[model samples]
Target: MKLKSVFINTTNCITPLGLDVETNIRNISKGISGIRLHKNLVYAEQPFYASIIENSLIEEAFSSVSSSEEYTRLEKMMILALMPVIKKMNPVFDEKTILIVSTTKGNITQLSTISETSAQSADLSLMAQKIASFFGFITEPVIVSNACVSGILSLAVAKRLIQSEACNQAFVVAGDEFSKFVLSGFNCFQAVSNEPCQPYSVNRKGVTLGEAAAAACVSANGQNALAEIVGDGAINDANHISGPSRTGEGLFRSVERAMKEAEIKSEQIDYINAHGTATSFNDEMEAIAFNRSRLGNVPLNSLKGYYGHTLGASGLLETVIGIESLNSGKLYPSIGFDEMGLSQALNIITQNEEKELNYLLKTASGFGGCNTAVLFKKAK
Candidate 1:
């Protein structure tokens, strides 16, 4: 059976660098980075580098559209990121339109500062419902929080739903805010970076945490469509709880499966937007996976150096930017990378350059051995 085609209609991002695609792309093109040294506040004993959106900025943006004055930071950011896209599209919020929210730890910060309303504030379902209700969505919200892959997985889920005729359109919003709990948890495993992350680099230490919210509209008949979500594959190695498979078995299989579904050869890929969290294992594992899949020669770059690792938001956020790159015929450099670090010799974009991009591959690997690969074709 021929599957129905799904496309990303509109996109929005709320990041430290900017709140829209154009601004983020401009700053990224100029090599501007949002990751910076941040003083440890109830998370670490020392300062650490991360890409964080200013609370004041989030509030200002939220206040402009809302007046409740009681929304949590996470809610505010998610709403702000989603508002523009929904407004621009003016999509109907009927039963045919579904709201899918992807987040790792929704309102987790409430745990650090428990209050009388802490229980409700920390409820993921409640947060999802609140956001959906705000937009008057008739259907219940679907939550996808599969570690860091939540963002991209959400897109995959929406595509499948559209193809299944379960929904005519889907509004996918994903976000995660930095919190004492999240930072301390990563610190416990010594995965927090001390400086700006250098993904796919030999000198890379670890991942720098970040916070951002991104949203996209997906439908069968895409208006202002940027790219078509052609194929996707998700797999898990069950190797370890906190670490990825040493051989990148899961990632390799995932990439292979996605490419097969996409019906494209390795050489047909124009570029790769890797998950490159800059961690020792992640970058190394990706190199092995790409080489094993015969995609080692494709030019690739990680956006972590610019926005750090925004956990659940990274996949979708990067996918949005990748679409922009495809339209502009430009590839952004992998900042903070000066040399090859992995065992396999892989192509890494060192500087911004123009290229004819037709098919782009976005991959994400997260804890619990979860890995996902998504193939997108430039919309004709």
Candidate 2:
């Protein structure tokens, strides 16, 4: 039996730079970064750089959607990110439709209080259900929580579910919010950058955390699709609890599998949206993996400088922008890069350029040695 084709039909995102996709793209094209230094002791003991959405902006935008005061800030962001897509497509919430929520920490701030209501709010399943119900989705919602890869991995999951005849249409929403818990955890690992992150740069210190929510519609129907989901692969090296494989073994294998499934060579790839978190090990590991996959020469860029590693939202947010890149034939620069810092060389995009792009590759690696690669072809 032949498998069905899956395509991303519509996309939207809520970020510190903008609320809509076009606005975000405009800011990015102008080299505007959302990362800012914050001295709030609630989030960190010392001043730290991060991309954070303004509370007033979120409240104002969400007021037009719903007047309920019960929704958490993260939920509002998720709803805002998904609202535009749902309005544009006006998809029917039927039995054949599924909702997928991806996140690393859902309302983890609720835990700071340690109350019954807070505990329920922190539950990932409950959060997913609430989002689903808010949209009037009849089917039970699905949760994807695989470290930092949750966003992109959710898309892969949607593809498989549609292909397997389990669901004809899928609504995927991914998000993570800034909280003291997350900041302290990364602080413990000494992975929080003091300034805006510089991926693959000699001066790079570490990652800059951000909060965002992104949504995409995946369906078997190819009508008005942004891009065709051709292939995807995910692998886990289990090298360490926090560190990625030193040899890029899992990432290399993941890319190999994706290319094989797509039946394409690395030379055919027009550009790569890499998971360049600016961490020493992650940047080095990705450089190695791309070179091993013969993708070293492909023009690549990391959106971390612009968005500051939005945790679960990074992959999907980057993927949304990448889809725009394919549609517009424009490449955005890797914002904070100065000089090559990795042992393996990569063709990092430094300035905005227009080119006829056909195939785009998006990759993400995260804790627990998890790595994912998904291939997309420009929709004709």
Expressed as tens digits, the lDDT of each residue in 191-273 for candidate 2 is: 98887999999889999999999999999889889999999999997788799998899999988988998899999999999
Cα shift from native, residue 356, model 2 (Å): 0.7
Per residue, candidate 1 scores C-alpha lDDT tens digits across 229-301 of 9889999977997898989999899889889999998999999999999899989999999999999999999
- The alpha-carbon deviation from the true structure for residue 351 of candidate 2, after best TM-score superposition, in angstroms, is 0.4
| Candidate 1 lDDT (Cα, 0 to 1) | 0.91
Candidate 2 differs from the real structure by a C-alpha RMSD in angstroms, to one decimal, of: 0.8
Provide the clash count, candidate 2. Answer: 0
Highest lDDT model number: 2
RMSD vs true structure, all candidates: 1.2, 0.8
Models 1 onward score TM values of: 0.98, 0.99
lDDT of 2 at 213: 96
TM-score of 1: 0.98
